[model samples]
Target: MSDPVRLGDVLAGMATPGGGGIPAQPGAGGTTCNRCGARADWHRTIRDKWILIELGEWPVGAVPPGKRWRVAGEGTAVNLGRAQPSDTCRICHFDVCPSQPAPVGSPALLAQWQKNAWG
Candidate 1:
């Protein structure tokens, strides 16, 4: 059999900000596609522990708080939970856990970053 695919790499490839991967929606500005690093809307899915992800960003108050994209395939569809803004990005979530609390205008941004996190 082939090797286990890298979820992060796969997400980056399929991520297309506007062309299906991710589009510039409200509330999602500054956030780029983790895969392609493009500012587009993306979709996400977690199948058998392998997550398929995407993302995008846009101006303020244009999109909803955390209603970004959708997850495909079947299993137990879990929605994006509450917004938690920490000092470090998701790469540090499990490793660092943020010693200090997030500053202002961070919770939203943090959530956005996490939405696009692969590591």
Candidate 2:
């Protein structure tokens, strides 16, 4: 097996806002793909036994949120159930580390960096 890609490499061009917070879409809370600049879906796995026990079998809902990707141009969403690590671009299908930490900088700088890297 190959080594996992670092998240920092993927978010190289995306800027961190003034508060050093990730820019997410309203309601969706998704960040732009570092490869294609399209919305990338994310999900957090709840593996804590104590939290699961406290919430009971049903937990937060009948089913936990699963990983999904929105297709660029097509505007279609694909649900990828719990599986291996995906560090690829949803639109371009290029390898990218989406789990890595984002870089800190202004939006303009980040955008320029991304364009230079991708373009």
lDDT of 2 by residue, 35-62 (tens): 4454434322122110000101121122
Give the TM-score of each candidate.
0.18, 0.18
| Model 2 misplaced regions, further than 4 Å | 1-28, 47-119
Encode model 1's per-residue lDDT on 13-103: one tens digit a residue.
5553343434433234234444435343222333212222323223333223343223324322223333333221112121112222432
Error of 1 at 18 (Å): 19
- lDDT score at residue 105, model 2, on the 0-100 scale: 37
Report the lDDT of model 2 for residue 31: 51
Best by lDDT: 1
Give Cα-based local distance difference scores for all models.
0.34, 0.31
